[model samples]
Target: MTRIIAAVATAALLLTSTSAFAQAAFPTRPNTLQGQAACAGYTVDNYKERFAANSGGPDVQLHSLCAGAYNYYWMYLNAIRKGFSESDCNVTYDAFDKAARVVTNFWAETH
Candidate 1:
């Protein structure tokens, strides 16, 4: 009985700790910006900066940070649309969208 109780407790703890948080996909509404096309000026740079900062300023990325910024921003915006208050939107979407647009514009102009 004692061994069984311990095993059950251990399993319960594992189940609780391993519970995954729901990370929903971004919506396809007009509100969501994709790549450097819709966003041209500020989206890329700002996100790059943020990613670098998060990485302790080494400024390395295995994948495109711009893409991550766009996705993260879109996801948060999705949260707001799902029921977050207008004031609680946290403005992350705007930041990412701005960077994406800037980057897009720069590439378009240069190329």
Candidate 2:
């Protein structure tokens, strides 16, 4: 009985440690557009609402990846507004264009 209890305790400890490690690893921001947008708290709904408000049109529909790319572009604009160098924000434009192209291509294919 004691041996069984020790084994169970060991298993629980291992699981707890692994879960902690995974949680720590999960939220790391990679040096990429999607990663940056996620770190900045951008979400699909936020993107949709902002796009509609800015365009004076209906809500824009986007896949999660596409929305994230757009959010990254928005982040670049925000950075510019906050006095960041345009050159520093230029990389995000490429990322946004790539994502937008993918979405546009998919739409073209579908319709």
What overall lDDT, based on C-alpha atoms, would model 2 receive against the true structure?
Answer: 0.44
For candidate 1, report its TM-score: 0.37
State how far residue 108 of model 2 sits from its true place (Å).
0.8
Provide the clashing-pair count of each candidate structure.
14, 0
TM-score of each: 0.37, 0.43
Top TM-score: which candidate number? 2
Each prediction's Cα lDDT score?
A: 0.44, 0.44
Per-residue C-alpha lDDT of model 2 across residues 3-26, encoded as one tens digit per residue:
433433443344344322111211
- The true-versus-predicted C-alpha distance at residue 39 of model 2, in Å, is 23
Error of 2 at 90 (Å): 0.5
Writing each residue's lDDT as its tens digit, candidate 1 over 2-111 gives 44334334433433444334533344334334443423332423655545455553323322444454654654455444544333333444444554455455546645
Q: What are the root-mean-square deviations of the candidates from the true structure over C-alphas?
A: 15.3, 16.3
Off by over 4 Å in 1: 1-65
Determine the C-alpha RMSD for candidate 1 after optimal superposition of all C-alphas: 15.3
Error of 2 at 64 (Å): 1.9
